[model samples]
Target: MEIEYQYHFSLPRSVVWKYIKNERVLKNALPGCRSFSMVSNNIYKAEMDIHIGPIQDLFTLEIRLDEDQAPSLIELHIKGNGNMGQLNGQALLMLKENQGTTMLSCKANGQVTGALGLAGKRILDSSANKGLENFFQILEKEIKRRIYELKRRNR
Candidate 1:
């Protein structure tokens, strides 16, 4: 399946890029993301719960951040399995300054198996879209909140 989304952040591109590259920041962005800790230089152990239609799964994601251009572009690769199936994808991210904010465009392509694959194509598409939307919403909120908190501390 192919999934894509675009969003604008209330921060500069450089600052947003730097903040997003951190595993700790990512952990906070996900909904019900209990914990995400870096196990090595580019490997992380992440746990998150996601739902689609009548199906839900607590996903344990092993993520590896590869091919970094640092504060410019990056590739996020994930590999793991859960109640749904083996989930793997590479998210290609490009950030640009839009007006005074940062605009992020991501293209995600991945697949599913097991019970989720048995659900059908329509279910897969809708589920993927909704899951990604929820993820972005939570992620964006966390980013803004953290930045706000950081500024408050500095003040």
Candidate 2:
């Protein structure tokens, strides 16, 4: 399956890039994430509880940052396995600054196998989209909180 999304953040591109690369922020933003840790440079291992349609399972995911261009672009490759299935995917994220706002565009392509694959493309797409939306909402809140804390500390 393939998915694409675009989002605008009220913060500057530099700030958005910093938060996006922070492990703490990502762990908090991901839905159902049990653990997220860096295994090596640009590589991370994560355990998450995933529920998609009628399937629910605990997945172990290996995420690799394949390419990075500072505050502009990032490419990621992911591999995951669970009792329900196996998942492999790649994603590209691009960020552009407009005024003080940061615009993010993401494109992801993936394939699923086993029981999860039986859930069909429509269900998978819907679930993925919902998960992304939830992630972004939580991420926004986390970023704002961090910014507030920084300001308070400097005051």
Candidate 3:
């Protein structure tokens, strides 16, 4: 399966980049995430409860930051398994700044096995798209909240 998404933030690319890699920000943004912890410098382990169509399961995922070009690009590799299925994927995220706004583009490709593989492409695609959208919305809010906290602290 493949997923692509684009989002615009009313903040500079540099500011977005500064907070994007924060563990707290990511943990708060990820939908249904129960636990998220770093396993190494660039690797993380996460447990999430995911629901797709009529199927729901708790997934254990290992995420690796494969490549990073600060304030511009990031590449990620992920693998996860649950009672429903297993998944493996790679994602490339690019950020472009225009004036004070930043545009984020994400492209991801993955394969699923077991029950999830039999769930059909349309269902999977819809669920993935919705999930990504929700994640980004929450992320933007979290970033803004953090920025507010920073300003308060500096005052």
Instruction: Quote model 3's TM-score.
Output: 0.97
- Candidate that scores best on lDDT: 2
Candidate 2 has an lDDT of: 0.92
Candidate 3 minimal-lDDT segment of 10 residues: 65-74
TM-score of model 1 relative to the true fold?
A: 0.88
Which stretches in model 3 have alpha-carbon errors above 4 Å? none
lDDT score for residue 127 of model 2: 99
C-alpha lDDT of all candidate models, in order: 0.79, 0.92, 0.92
Per-residue accuracy of model 1 over 17-66 as CA lDDT, tens digit each? 77676777788787778789999987889987767668788889888877
lDDT of 3 by residue, 1-155 (tens): 99999999898999888877778999999999999989899899999998989889999999998556777999999999999999999999999999999999999999999898888999999999999999989999999999999999999
- After TM-score superposition, the amount by which residue 8's alpha carbon in candidate 3 deviates from its true location, in angstroms, is 0.5
- Candidate 3, 55: how far from true, in Å? 0.6
Q: Which segments of model 2 are wrong by more than 4 Å?
A: none
